[model samples]
Target: MDSVKLGLKENWKQFALLVIVNGFVGGMVGMERSIFPQFAEVEFGVASKTAILAFITAFGISKAVANYYTGKLANKFGRRTLLLFGWLLAIPVPFMLIYAPSWTFVIIANILLGLSQGLTWSSTVVMKIDLVGEKDRGFAMGLNEFAGYFAVGIVAFITGYVANSYGITPYPFYIGVFLSIVGFLLTLFWVKDTRDFVKKEGKNNKTVELKNVFLETTFKNKTLSSVTQAGLINNLNDGMIWGLLPMVLFSLNFDNENIGIITAIYPAVWGIGQLFTGKMSDHYSKKGMLFWGMLMQGIAILFIPYSSEFAVLAGLSAILGLGTALVYPTFLATIAQATSPQQRAESIGTFRLWRDLGYAFGAIISGVTADIFGVEYAILTIASLTIMSSLIIKFRMPVNIKTVRK
Candidate 1:
């Protein structure tokens, strides 16, 4: 831990770059997420229920695909080049959504947005693990997720307010475009390659192999498998919360402002709570942190349908956030610890691909369920799925911590 801490402190420039690039990437995605549902409703006259699903489906599919390639690209070309390319792809995203002649254009933008997410955001997480090594990985991941989601929560609320005031959804898209351009430029001008970190450690001379990069080797380790599975479930719940919560509020007859306030609470709490949770991961077993986090998330989801008042719902949202905070960083730390340093990028990418697929699976399932039954029923179903996932982790998985060295 002391050596890891010293390395991070000495490489402050690299870590600062990670924080800024990842934070901006988060804000870019957050901007889209904040406004897309309203755009679907106001521009295409799509129902709130159906439109949100479009964004989720596009995001899930594109991110899933991009996760596979991002690792390979990072391995072949190096992380900085791939990251720069990803930021460039983001430049047109907001314009596509804002000037979209049909819902299909907005969907296309989301696909591109998802690509940016996988390439930039997912890669940044892997990069952090690269820089921080094993011992301080939890704290590093906590800071990473905290910056990203906190930007999302704040930007979502602000953009939601912008939409309500102007009654023009494109305004937010325009803002997203500008921010993404800034992020792109920042990466181009300021961010440096951490491949030097790997090179400095003399691992860069090894042959790059693609075989088994995406295979059972990933699942061969019990600890890695548990963390990966838990990550999938955690992201499954995240997809539900981000994909369906607004519609849940809409179904309850809340306006955009109220929806924004309610929607903001989950990520806000999740983001802020990481400060403590990240430190806790250092002192406790990663498995213990994850197990309790999943349990709390399940309990929070169960409480969602029962809360009729905004205050109670907000409280439940915070509880869910805390649960997410507990699990999110620990999961990343576990993945970093379980894999060899040389293969960390590919391993984390593979892990994220599975976790992100949970978003697609949860969205399609919950969307169809909501269409058939109602929002409350959809919430209940996701709650049940989450609880089942928690049980799987608690009972079936081994509780152990593994660490790899540089």
Candidate 2:
């Protein structure tokens, strides 16, 4: 621990292991991405769109709150403790979902899931930043998100197939049970604490000039605030997709398997595309990448309801994924770059608090809109909101914002 070094190559073993752990963390949520909403409607007879999307609402709110605390606690307790404790919270989520007898039970399960995700995912993000230092922060973030979301896509695809075959109850959620145990064991035994690395980096670093971390990351600093809002709205539209995409296809007469395919494709492309886009942010202007990425996401989302053909919808979903790939890792990289090592975790937690809150907002807003005007109009409104977020990024963010580099 005393010989701690910074760089992905230096920490590749732990970095690789954390990536895998985060994948399982992602898989914990991915299992539901394709099946949960449909399960609510079909299994429990949930009739209201708001009621069907209640789980996402529960998840978003809990995760947002958890993200804020995970930061504060990680600094106090250590990242590994938070990571393990997060998995402990996750232990019951799968069984709750599998054996749930009421819609309320499902929502309860999501509350736990959100808490677990906030801690585990947030811990991994901080751990990776701790290990990689400043050199390839973008690439490191890209890898972290890629592993997590790709696993999301993979599990979503698998669960969709399972639900199509075994019904939504017992099989689809079995993935979560397996992931919860494996994520806990691997994180406990294999992953090491990276807080020392942060200490090491801080010793030799002259770059970071700290600010009021919460206020600056949340709203005070120009570039940080821009990234924060973009992250919020990015996930805002994503929450719309997570809660509504499968339902839209189902209403269009698409079967469960097909629904999974369409649903899986979006994050699949998003997960895989970040392989390059993350590195691109390291080299290119983050502002440009964010501007175009948000614009593309808005466009892709706007076209989803209008496209009746499977190919076209799939194409649009892929486009949406690509757009997200461009910005998702960039968001974290930029946030990490903006703050000092001491402040990084808290700042990240703040950014993620608002970002995950978009999930709640998207679910509630889309759910209410879907209930009132229908899903199509709800989606249209969400897309318009996304486009507006992009414009905010374009005009409000400083063109030449400085980021701390160690």
Best by lDDT: 2
TM-score of each: 0.92, 0.98
lDDT by residue (61-133, candidate 1, tens digit) is: 8887787688766767878788888888888888887778998887888889888888998778777766765
What does candidate 2's lDDT look like per residue over 1-406, in tens digits? 5678799999999999999999999998889999877898889989899988888989999999999999888878999999999999999998998788888988998999999999999999999999999899999999999999999999999999999998988988888889999999998888888889889887867656655778888788889999999999998899999999998898899988999999999999999999899999899999989999999999999998889899999999999999999999999998887777888899899999999999999999999999999999999999999999999999988776586564
Alpha-carbon RMSD, candidate 2: 1.3
Number of clashing residue pairs in every model? Answer: 0, 0
Best by TM-score: 2
Task: Give the Å shift of residue 252 in candidate 1.
Answer: 2.1
